[model samples]
Target: MNKKQETKYELILNAAFEQMKEKGFEKASISQIVKRAGVAQGTFYLYFDSKGAIVPAIAERILEEQLGLIKSEVKENDSIDRIIDVLIEQTFKLTDRNKEVIKFCYSGIAYYDSFQRWEDIYRPYYLWLEKKLEKAITTKEIAQRKSISHQAIFIIGLIEQSAENYFLTDEPKKDEELNLYKQDLYHFIKRAIS
Candidate 1:
């Protein structure tokens, strides 16, 4: 599609999100999205099968965007701890601003029977972590674990678990406390692995 088409599709998706937030996901209407987007109702159908498609699409976009930050932050020669710290800090910061997006992720799974597989949407982070784990082992910085793949997966899963909490609960951490938590987590992971 052309740039104009892509822009309109994005606008429709953005409007759908606002409507979903204001009205709960199940109750958010297609007309509301179209009206808010200033798009003809027909235009929305041309882009998304339903508002459900937009939920996963938005999630996929977020993962892709954040993974780019990870790529730029991690240098080839950086220590495993530094790489992990970069991932942790950038992820926590990203999640702070995009709580609604993360909420929509879990809500997508709950509400949309047909939402895309999260693995497919989030493949880049998985692949990057896998590569880092491989390097850490070769450098002897990472101790042998029960399948490094599983460990790396678990680490990412832990962050996602944090994301869910960060979305749904009121964190008592002031900024300083949160920084300490990040440092503690980094040290814990580094010691646990290396």
Candidate 2:
């Protein structure tokens, strides 16, 4: 896609994201998204076949943003503790900001066969974590795992689930409580990998 196409694509995506967040994947309509995007309905069809088709695209955009943040904030030479702290902090903030979109993408992807590309969308983020694990293992910073791939997935599952539970469910936490939770999570992950 060229620059204009990219802009229109993003507009449609942002519109879809807002609509999905507000009305959910089941209720958000293609008409609503296109109308909100100020684009022709045909324009949306040019980018996505159906409402469900947008899920992986949304997931890709969100994960790509998160990966960018991770790469910029977490240094290669950072110690394990620093790495954990940064990951937890950054993941929590991202989850807090985009919890609804995250929730929508998780559910929305399941209904579309094309969303099988979900794993492909997430592969880069997973590979980045895997590389971190490999480096840690080589430096004796974390225990050697039989499969670094599984280890990376486990770490991501833990962090994402915990963030969802903490930020997306129940009552909100105070700053001190949130800090304690982060500390406990950091220690839990540290011990598990060590």
Candidate 3:
């Protein structure tokens, strides 16, 4: 796609994201998204088939963004413990910032038939974590595991679920509480992998 098309596509996506975050997936309409994007309604069809179709795309985009951020923050020579620290910190911040969008994506994908694409959307992030786990095992930073893939998935689940619970729950946690939670979570993951 050319620059103009790419720009329009992102505009539509951004508009949809905003709409979904503000009004939720069920209530957010295509027309509203197109209007917010400043594109014709037909243009939305050019990119996405329906509102539900955008869920996976949005999920893919968010995952890609998170993966990029995490990769940028982590260095090649960093120890596994340091890597876990960065992962937890960055994931928490991102989850807190995009809690609404994350919720919308989860609910939207859950209700739609596009839920099958969920694994595909997360595959890159999963593979990245798997690679890290493999390296940690090679370097003796973590215990040798029969299934590095499962370890990666478990680590991701631990970090993401903990972050969501801390940030998205009904009761808000203070900064000190977040610090304690992160410390406990870090040790738990460390012991599990060690």
Candidate 4:
């Protein structure tokens, strides 16, 4: 796409992101997205077929941002425990910072098949973690296991669910209680895998 087209494309996506944040994926409408984008409705159709069609793009953007934050926190020589800590910390930080997007994605899963495309968007993170776990298992850093795929999936689910529960939930939590929960979560996962 040329510069002008690129600008319009970004405007639509950014507008869609904002709409999804405010109204949620299921309720966020194409017309609102186009209006917020300052583009004609026809322009939206040029880029996306429906509101649902935009979800995979949003999911990809959100996951990429989270992965970037996680990668930034880890050093080349970090130990498995340290990496896990960084992962947890970064995951919580991202969820807290982008709570609306996280909530939209989670809630969208209940309503939109496009939301299930997360597995594809998350493939890189999954493979990266799987490779790390495979090495750990081989070196006996984590317990030797034949089911690395299962283990990797468990780890992903653990982080995603825990972060959503603690950081993205509407439920109120006191600072002290939240800290304790985070510590407990860290220890629980550490013990489970290490």
Candidate 5:
């Protein structure tokens, strides 16, 4: 697509994201998204078949943004422990910031056509984490003889689930308590792998 098309595409996605956050995935209307994007309703159909079609784009965009932020913060020579710390911090920070969108994405996986495309949407992010874990093994930082894929999944799941529990679940936690939990979690994973 050209510059104008790309700009309008971004606008529509941004509008959809904002609308989903404000009104929720189920309630956010396509017309409002188009209107907020300043694009004709037909233009939305030109890019996306339905509101659900945009859900995967939202999920993909969130993952890519988080991955970029994490990559920028981590260096090639950083210790494995530092890498893990950065991953946990970045994942938690982004997940907390986008709780609404993340929740919507999960709902999309459950209810929309996104379930069939889950692997396609998330494989790159998962592979990136797997490679990071593989690097730790090669550097002799990770002593355990475990599958990098499993390790990556475990680490990512722990961080994401912890963030969800703190931000999206009904359980209440104070700032101090949350920080303590993060420290405990960081240490637990570090000891388990390294």
Candidate 6:
């Protein structure tokens, strides 16, 4: 798309994101989005079919943004421990950057009955993690007691849970506390594999 079209699309999506955060996905409406965006109502339909369609777009954009960051950090030649650190660090970094979007995914959005759409955005990144686990298993960088796919799910779930815990708190604990939690988590995971 041309620059103008790209800009319009971004404007609409960003407005939608803000509305969704304030009113939630189920309550957020197209009219509100276009109004906030200062774009015509017709312009919304020019891009998205419905709020449900926008949901996937938000999820896809979120995943792509963070996955791009993560892809840069992981070393193809790095050991499993190093990769784990990279993965956890990238996960937390992205969580801090897009906490709203992350909360939306696990919040009322997940109950939308469009499970496939939610899964679509996550599948690519989850598959990438699975591939990494598979490679580590094959290279003996990590243990092979379980299937790499299962291990990937474990890693993804752990990251999500940890991040949710971190973001859900109000006081915002210190960096040292978070680091110690991560270290403990890593050792627990290592024990399972070792």
* Number of the predicted model whose TM-score against the real structure is largest: 3
Model 5 CA deviation exceeding 4 Å by range: 144-146
Candidate models: Cα lDDT each: 0.78, 0.88, 0.90, 0.81, 0.85, 0.78
Which lDDT value does model 6 have at 48? 80
Residue 150 C-alpha lDDT in model 2: 91
TM per prediction: 0.85, 0.91, 0.94, 0.88, 0.92, 0.82
Q: Model 1 — TM-score against the truth? A: 0.85
Clashing pairs in 3: none
Poorest lDDT segment (10 consecutive residues) of candidate 5 = 113-122
**Residue-wise C-alpha lDDT for candidate 6, range 95-173, written one tens digit per residue:** 8877776666555355555677777777888899888777778888777765776777788778767876886668769
lDDT of 1 by residue, 29-128 (tens): 8898999999999999898887776777777777777888888999998888888888887788778867766776677766676444776776668878
Model 2: lDDT of residue 59: 84
Worst 10 residues of 6 by lDDT: 105-114
Tens digits of per-residue lDDT for model 5, 1-194: 99999998999999999999998899999999999999999999989988988988898899889889989998888888888888888888998899988898888767776676876766777798887777888888888565877777788778778877778887777889878878888998998887
Q: Write the per-residue lDDT of candidate 2 for residues 1-194, one digit (tens) a residue.
A: 89999999999999998999899888999999999999999999998888989999998888888888888988879876787777788889999999888888878887887555987887888898898889988899888889999988888879878988998886956889988998899999998999
Output the lDDT of residue 148, model 6: 70
Best by lDDT: 3
Residue range 90-190, candidate 3, lDDT tens digits: 89998988898989888888867775699878778889888888899999988898999988889988999999989888895677999999999999999
Per-candidate clashes, comma-separated: 0, 0, 0, 0, 0, 0
Q: Alpha carbon lDDT of residue 16, candidate 3?
A: 96
Summarize candidate 4's per-residue lDDT along 1-194 as a digit string, tens digits: 99999899889999999998898777889989999999999999898887767777777888888788778877766677877787788778877887888777666655577534777888888887888787777667889777878777788778878988887667888889867877888889889987
Cα displacement (Å) at residue 67, model 3: 1.0
